[model samples]
Target chain A: MKRTITLTVNNRPGVLNRITNLFSKRNYNIESITVGHSELEGVSRITCVVNVDNENIIEQITKQLNKQVDVLKVTDISDQAIVSRELALIKVLSTPNTRSEINALIEPFRATIVDIGKDSLVIQLTGESEKIEAFIELIKPYGIKELARTGTTAFLRGTQRTSNSTKNISIV
Target chain B: MLQETAFTKMKADNKPISGSELLLQALEKEQVEVIFGYPGGAVLPLYDKIYDSKILHVLPRHEQGGIHAAEGYARITGKPGVVIVTSGPGATNIVTGLTDAMMDSLPLVVFTGQVATGVIGSDAFQEADILGITTPITKYNYQVRNIEDIPYIVKEAFYIASSGRPGPVLIDIPKDIATAISEPPEEKEINIPGYQPTLQPNYLQIRKLTEAVSSAKKPVILAGAGVLHAKAAAELKQYAEQQQIPVVHTLLGLGGFPAEHDLSLGMAGMHGCYTANMALYEADLLINIGARFDDRLTGNLESFAPNATVAHVDIDPAEIGKNVPTEIPIVADAKEALKQLVAQEGKLPEHKEWLTQLQNWKKEYPYFYDNTSSLKPQKVLEMLFEKTKGEAIVVTDVGQHQMWAAQYYKFSKANRWVTSGGLGTMGFGLPASIGASFADRDACVLAILGDGGFQMSTQELAVIKEFNLPIKIIILNNMALGMVRQWQELFYEGRFSHSKNPVQPSFVKLAEAYDIKGYEINSVEEAETILNEVFSNNEPALLDFRVDPNENVYPMVPAGKGSHEMVGVKP
Candidate 1:
C-alpha cells in the first residue's frame, strides 16, 4: 500500500537528515518527499509518500517518525480527504510544424507553454499526479527533452488542521 | 574608567563562563556524582574543568571500557550513567557500548568532543560526524552549536536519557564551543513536544487486563528489563503472587523476578529453559509487561503463544504491537500499570492445574549438564552460585558462558545480573564489571568471560589494578568461540571454520603482569578449592578454568523454528 504521511517539525538544522535517516534505518522505501516552511514561525511541514505492505507497517512508520525529537506532529493523511497537487515542467522537442499542435493539445489540460525555444517547448503543469502523468504520456510522442517534478504537497480539503494549533506546545 | 565600570557591572550582573565550566555547573545541577571518562585532545578544555570539579572521574584504559563501566554503574545504581570522551576515534570507540545500552534500555548521557564548529565538515584531524553516526542508535542526539546552549542541552540530555523508556542520549560539543565564554542561558522546564511518554495506563485497559486475568485458565506473566527500569519488581512479584500467575523472564529480565519463587519459570527464548519455553507455548493468556517481543523470545511469531491473548504493558507505544499482535495494549510505566493491577478488585481464578503442569515440566526438564567427566561451564556457574549464595552482582560476556551464567547463577533481585543481552558485545563483561564494582565498594562483583571474549577487553585489567577494585574475574576457557562453534557444529556439520582459537596468550601471566592475583583451574576436581581460595580474600583476582571444548548450550529453539520445536531437550 502507498501512504502519505505529513509531519510538522522544528525548523532546525539537520532536521531533514534525521527524518530521512530514520526512514532509511527502518528500511522504509520513500517514494517522494516535499518539505517547506509551515504556517507557524520556526516550523516546517514535510509531506512524505512511502510504500509499505499494510496498515500495520504505516502505523509503525508513523510511530517511528513521531519518535524523532524534532518532529512535532505526524499525521497519516492518506485516507483523509485531501487537496493535493504536484507541479511538473516538461521540456518537449518541438518543430515549427508541431508547435501549434502541442499548444492546441495542452490547452484542454490547462497546461501553459511557459517557455518556447527554437527547438523545444517547456510546458508547465500543476495538478494531481495522475493528470501530470497523462499530460506527459500525451506529449511523449513529441519527445520529452527534459522533465522536472516537485513531489506531491497536500492539505486537508476543509478547515480541519493536520496538526493541533501550536499555541500551547513549546517550539524548542 | 567607563570600560572598567562596564566590565565590573557585567561581572556583577551575570558572569560569563567558558562552555566547559558551564557544563560542569549544569552537571552539578543535575546532581551528577560520578563520571566514567577517558581524556583526549578534543576534550582537553573539558578535562581541565573536570580537574577542579567535585565530580569523581574514573578513567578507563580505553573509551569502550569507560562506556561499559558507565552502563554497569547505571544498571546497579538506577541512575543515568554519564560518560565523556574525545572526538573521532574516541567517540567511535564507544559505538558498541552505546548500541548495547540502547538495546538494553539503560539510561546513559554520553558527551563526545567534536573537532571544532568550523572544521566539523572539513574532515579535520581527529574529527568525525558523531551525530550522524549515532542518529540511529541514540534516543536523541544534539550537536552544540552555541556555547550558551550547553546548560540547556546537558539538562535536556539527562532528562531524555533517564525518563520514560530509558536509553542512551549523546551530546557532541565542538572544541571551540568548549573554549568559548558566554553568559549561561536562563533555566527553563525541559519540554520536548514530540517526546512525551505516557506514564499512566487507561483505567478501561486496566479493567480489560483484570477481566482477562480473572478468566484465564492458563495465564503467564512475561517480564523484561522494563520491570527493572521502572523499579517495579516488587509490584510485579506482588501481582503475580496475588493472581497465582507463573512468571517467565526475558534474558535481560533475569533479576526482575526472584528465580527461587515457585511461580518463577526461569528465562524464556532461544536459549531459555525448557519449562519457561513450554509455559509460553501453552499459556492461554500472556501478560507481557515491559518486554518487547524480540525475535529471540518469540521464535516464529506465528507459533509463539498462538493460543494466547496478549496484554502488553510498556512505556513505549511502538513496542506494544511491533513484533507480536497485542490484543490489549497499555502504554504506561510498568510500575504504575502493575500497581493499578494490584489495586483492582477482582475474583481471579486459581490456576491449580496449570501450576501443577508447569511444576511438573520444571522438574522433568530442569537445566542439567554432565559434570562427572570434565569441567563443564555450567558447573563453574553452579559452584559460583553456591559459594556466592547468589548475592554477587554477576556480569558476563557473550557466548556459551553467558548462557550458562543466565541458567545456573540465578539472581534474586533486580540489577544483580548484568550482561550485554541485546547487542551481545563480546568485550562487555570486564569493563561493565569494573563499573559495577564502583557502584558499591563492599559488594562482590563478578565478571564471567569466555576465552575469546576475555581477550577482547583484557586491556581493562590495568583499570582493576589501578583502582584495586575487588572484582572476581572468571574466564571459562573453552579455547574456542563457543557459541559460534556450537552453531557451526549444529547447523554447518561440524565445520569449525576459524571458530577455534589455536593460539592464545597466557591470561594468568597477563594478570600477573598487571599485578593482580591469577588462579588457574585445569579440572573439575580443583574448581571448588580454587574458587574458595579466590573468594577467600577481598583483592581483585582472575580465574582461568579450562573447560570442555565441545560443550553446547541445550534446549535451543533453532533459528526460524517455533518455541515448541526446541531441540536437545533431555526427554
Candidate 2:
C-alpha cells in the first residue's frame, strides 16, 4: 500500500527546487506539494506528499533533508492522526440533463456550487486526501471541462498545538 | 520575566535597545566573549554595538585570517569558534576559511552584517547575499529578519554546530536586525522537524565485525580522522591494544592512535610507513574506523587490503558503502561503536609471528629521510619534537614537509596534531598555529611549512603581531612542491608538473618584515643552535631552514601497489 508522507517546508524561492532536486537525486517521485504561510512570522510551511517504497531510502532522505539550510524543519505526518484536505474546483459540463446527476455527486461530497453558468457548474470540495481523490475518480466519467487542485493542507487530530519536533521539516 | 519587563521598561525607560544592541546582547548571552572580524560601511551598526559591548573583538589583518583563527581555535578547543564580518567583500573574504573548516569538519559560527531588511534584494551598495555564497559550505545557515529572532538563531547555530558532525554555521544579520531591540532572549529549541540526527550503531553488524576481527589470523586496525573527530582516540587505542591489532593511520587520521604507542604504525598510503603498508597487505581483516578510503589511502582500490575483510565504522552513512565497500558497515560514531566492540569481544590472543614480522619491517626502514651533508628537513622535524618533547601542538602545511612531519613527529595525544588533510590546503599552518597558540596560551604551537606553502598565507603574521601570539613558525625552504616533484621524478620523468616554478620571496626577510624574530639554518650544526635559541624564547619566532631540494619522501609503495613493492632510496 502506498502511503503519502505529508511535509511542511519554508515558503521561499528554490524551496520547491531543493525538495524536488532531493527527490530526483534519490530517484524518488513526489506525488504532490502544497505551499503556504503558517501562524508564525518569517516562516512559511510547505506540505509535500511523496511516494516511496523503500523505507530506508525515505529515512535517509529525511535525515539528509534535515541537514539542508533552507529547510527550517520537516515532519512526516504519515503516522499522525490528522485531517488532510485538498481544495479542487471541478467545472463539469452542466447540460440541463446532467445538472441533477452533478448535484447528486456534490451532495454526497458536501461540496458547494460556488459558481454556475448556463452550461457549467463550479463545485468546491475539501476533506481527507483519499475522499478528494475518490470524488475526482467518480466525477471523471462526467463530461468534465476542467479541474484544478489547491494541493493539500493538513492538521493534527488532537488538541496538541503543533509539535516541538516540527523542527524536522526540511524545506530543502 | 525581567526580559518581558525590560521590553516594556525599555519602551518607557526611553532605553529601547537598537536591534544592533540586541544582537550584541544575544552574543553576550551565548558567551561569545570574542569575535574575530573586520568592519565595513554596511556593518557599521554592528560595529557601533561591538564598540560599546564588553566582548573583545580581534580585527584580522584580513577577513580570511579572522575566520581561519576561528577555525584553528575550534579545531584545538573542540568548541564552536565564532567570527563576525561585514557583508559583501568583508564577508566574501571569509569563504576560504569557511571551506577549510568545512573540509576539516571544525566547528565555527560566522556572523555577517547584511544590509537593512528593507534594502535586502534591492542590490543595495556594499550588500551581497552572504548566505548564498556560504550555503554550500556551511553545515547550517540563517538570515535574521527580526531582532527578536537573533538570540534564537544564535542558539540554534551553536546547537547545530556542536551537534552531529560539527562544522561551520553562518548567521547573516541585517543592519536593521542587528540594531533593533526587543525582550530578553527566549528559550527556544533548535529543532529540525522530522530531522532525526543519526547517532546509533547496529549491534548485529558490529557483532559480525567482531567475529571477523576475532577470527582473523592477521589483522590490523586502520584508524582515521573520524576517531579524532569523534574524540575516540583513547577508546581506539584501547580497542587496538585489546585485540593487539596494529594501528596504521591515514594522513588525516595520523593522531587517531597515540604516536608513542608501539601498536601505532604511523601513516600508510603514498607517504605511508613501509611496515604499515606491509602489515595492511598481510592483514586478513582490516578494521577501518572513521577513515574514508581516500584515493591517497587506497592508491589503487582494487589492490587495497586484498586479503582483508574490511569492517568500516563511520558517523556518516553515505561514507559507509561509497568507497571500498565494507564487509560490515557500522553507521555510528567511531567512539560510540568502538565501545560496543569492546563490550562484545574481550582482549585478543598474541600473534608473536605477526608482531615480529612487523617489527622487522619497521627496523629495516626506520623512517629516516636524512641527507646528512647539510641540514636535512628530517633533522628540523626531529629537533622540533625533541626540544618540545612533542608537548607542543604541531600544525603543518602540506608538501614534502608534511610527509616528514607525519613520519618523524610523534603525537603524544590526539587533536593535538592539526593539518589540512583532505583538501591538502596550503598556507594553513601559520594561521592555524596562531589560533592554536591563542587557544592554549601556555602551549607552544609549531606552524611547520615548506617555502611553497608558507607564501600561501604568511601575511597572517600581522594577526600574531596584533595579538602578540607566541606561536613558532618553522619554514622548510625547499623552493618547490617537493612532494609533487618526487612523484614527477619517479612517475613523470622529472618533468615537474605544478611542482617547481618561478623564484620565490625570501621568507627570513618576510618574517623580519613583520618585525618578528627570524633564523636561517644552512647546515645541520645550525639546526641545534636555531632550536636552542627559538625554544628558549617565548616570543613568536620563525626558523628558515635551507634543505636539499632533491630529497624525496621514502618508503613509497609506488602507485597501485602494496608494502611488498615499496622502493626506498636506500632500501
Output the number of the DockQ-best candidate. Answer: 1
DockQ of 2: 0.15
Candidates' C-alpha lDDT: 0.91, 0.78
TM-score of each: 0.96, 0.79
DockQ of each: 0.64, 0.15
**Least accurate 10 contiguous residues by lDDT in model 1 chain B:** B1-10
Model 1 segments more than 4 A misplaced: A159-172, B1-13
How closely does chain A match the true chain A in each prediction, as TM-score? 0.90, 0.82
Candidate 2, superposed: residue stretches over 4 Å from native: A1-172, B1-15, B345-347, B497-501, B557-570
lDDT of 2 by residue, B128-234 (tens): 87766776677767888777777678888887787667789998888777667665555577775533446679989988987777678888899988888788988
- Number of backbone-clashing residue pairs for each candidate, in the order shown: 0, 27
Instruction: Identify the leading candidate in terms of TM-score.
Output: 1
